[model samples]
Target: MTDYPVSNAAQAASSAYRLASLDQEFLLGDSTRGVRFQLEYQKAQEALRAYGVVSMLVVFGSARVRENGAGRQAFWYAEARAFGRIASLEGGALGGPPYANVVATGGGPGTMEAANRGAHEAGAPTIGFNITLPREQEPNPYTTPALTFRFHYFAMRKMHFAMHAKALVVFPGGFGTFDELFELLTLSQTGKTPRIPIVLVDQDYWRKVIDWRALRENGMVSADDLGLVEFADDGADAWAILKRAGIDAAPTVNNFPLGGT
Candidate 1:
């Protein structure tokens, strides 16, 4: 094998001469969008698997919430933080061969940061699925460095959320939060995913935002479908609701992975 530097600059500099695997421009081009999506999925999926995250207790809430803001913001942050600690400690995230019910969040500020901080304080590794955004988003410091992930596609991000979740806890949020919550609900309704306990914090807030009875009244969802939702006053209440709903049942489904659904 005669390994020598290329003598021809033109040939070495040509785009066609570049190896496909090393061609960053080509790989990032629109033509390779599918590859990029797959790369995002695999990167996160493999990292989670390596860290033994068998199941997740996913938390959803508004990114705009603050620890010392007006009215309900502080309360929301406190509750979410409390819930993260409870889930991580009691849900089998600590000291496990294959950690289950690990606290997971969207990996940004507000509720996500609160939850991740709680888990970190409890000395449990947590997962955060961050996404690329127009306004920009950053992963919370509390998430385990190896488990923090970033994605370019919302569909893939949501898929990761649902695929590994053993249960879900939702706090007051606007459009993005609602979209994530309802998407999981739709998956449950359509039998696309295994049924998991879903608890909504602050019944007052949720009630004001959603007319649950109205949906049933409107024939949009059945009474049985209504059973899919449980309400809680705060983090402790949410944990209790999950316990009653049996969030700790089966613990090793491998999240079905990114490619599964």
Candidate 2:
């Protein structure tokens, strides 16, 4: 029997047409419109795979943040920065390490850039999966060339983000940040993926989002559902929790003792 499941020639041609349109718009170059977004996206994904990242920590937060903004957006940036550093250390501790990097916001400014900058400061490769937006989104320069990416498809980008994620560190932000964070939660709650660690930095910021106690009281979610999310006051605390959860192996033996003995 032939491998082709469809024996109808007309049906095959129709399918090909749909794929061709998508290719021209999202996966292939269409020079007629002077847009190479799709090509750039594929290039970025390939680059990230080549950068030796076996797993990644997807850092989600505000992209419209100013260093001196109202609210705690700046603090969120600081927390993400620290989280990136912790991700690098966790990467180093794992056996047969493949150098996990913190995949940041993928934009030039805001918390995404901060995470990438933190990884860069620690001399680690970082991934910035930038999306094409109307404005205020540019690829941060700190991303390692082979670890940076752009995507024409947000869904595809989200898939790639979750693909190699060992953990997720969420910072306080707006709608987009909430969407990404909840989607990850949904996936975990539904058994779409293994129970990886999800650290929500800053209890004050996240406490307002949902009342777990209320959910339990109303029987919407089990008491165990609360276990799905852990809160932290800062980056170091978040790292501590994630490290203990087996997202990556932690160093068991003390390699370097106190002072020169």
Largest lDDT belongs to which candidate?
1
User: Judged by lDDT against the true structure, how good is candidate 2?
Assistant: 0.69
Model 1 CA lDDT for position 171: 96
Candidate that scores best on TM-score: 1
Candidate 1 ranges with C-alpha deviation above 4 Å: 1-7, 255-261
Q: RMSD of model 1, in Å?
A: 2.6
lDDT of each: 0.90, 0.69
Candidate 2 residue runs with Cα over 4 Å from true position: 1-45, 93-97, 249-261
- Tell me the lDDT of candidate 1: 0.90
TM-scores for candidates 1 onward, in order: 0.93, 0.74
- Residues 1-261, candidate 1: write the lDDT tens digits: 456675676877999899999999999999999999888888888888888888899999999999997999999999999999988888888887588899999999999999999999999999899999998998989999998888889999998898888889999999999999999999898888878889999999999999999999999999999999999999999999888877773468654433454
Q: What local lDDT does model 1 show for residue 97? A: 52
Quote the lDDT for 2 in model 1: 52
Worst 10 residues of 2 by lDDT: 251-260
